[model samples]
Target: MAETDPKSVQDLTNVVQTLLQQMQDKFQTMSDQIIGRNILTEHSLNNDNAVLKRLKEHQKNPKRVKVHREVYLKRNMKSFTLKRFPQ
Candidate 1:
């Protein structure tokens, strides 16, 4: 059997180590990106849930109603003019 040179064997070992390190670094970066996306999605879901809850609570109450100020002013002005003219 032909014996392998010590220098060639050492070079092969170094190449394999470098490749492994590169793979590990890529895997860590992918994992961190996925985790960051998951965290952002979770926060978005939480905000949506809070907004829905507040809307539901607002719907359940009869007195806590919203009216546009412009519409209210127009309506009052009409009523005032009608009362003043009496027609």
Candidate 2:
């Protein structure tokens, strides 16, 4: 029932951009953490079910991962070549 003015739209856009940037920064930090790797690796070692899922999620989508993801993707992909293709 309410219409947004140009200023309101601009403000909303700025807020969304700011939030996206902050989310990306946080994701970068989390991805860079030893804990994240440790958890994934630990899960990997303990659970065969998770390996393909994680590898597929990381490898099938190039835009979602960091540059270093290639290393892990290859390492995991080697185990399940049929599960996914490289992006």
Candidate 3:
């Protein structure tokens, strides 16, 4: 990164600028995406909200459901009438 070659320095500078621009563009797009999203921050969720009420209710009355799984593996016996080819 501390090379004395002018061409190398210019290339490095260009690459860094391009990378910075790309990162900025990505950050802007991410910010734009979140602009209209219904995201809840920690402070907001801790405040008086319906989501907190629902969460408390869910914790008090958690549902219990039973799950059953069945698996079977079979191997068929085979009689080979085939011969191996010589290399």
Top model by lDDT, which number?
Answer: 1
List the lowest-lDDT window of 10 residues for candidate 2: 1-10
Sort all candidates by lDDT, best to worst: 1, 2, 3
lDDT scores of the candidates, listed in order: 0.83, 0.77, 0.59
Q: How much is the lDDT of residue 1 in candidate 2?
A: 15
> Measured by C-alpha RMSD in angstroms, how accurate is candidate 3?
14.6
TM-score of 1: 0.63
* Clash count of each predicted structure: 0, 0, 0
Worst 10 residues of 1 by lDDT: 1-10
Kindly list the per-residue Cα lDDT of model 2 for residues 26-49, writing each as its tens digit: 998987896878989988877876
TM-scores for every predicted model: 0.63, 0.33, 0.36
Off by over 4 Å in 3: 1-7, 38-87
Q: Let me know the TM-score candidate 2 reaches against the reference structure.
A: 0.33
Q: Give one digit per residue, the lDDT tens place, for model 3 in 1-87.
A: 557334777887988888899999999999977864545564566676877786677677655111111111111111122233333
TM-score-better candidate, 1 vs 3: 1
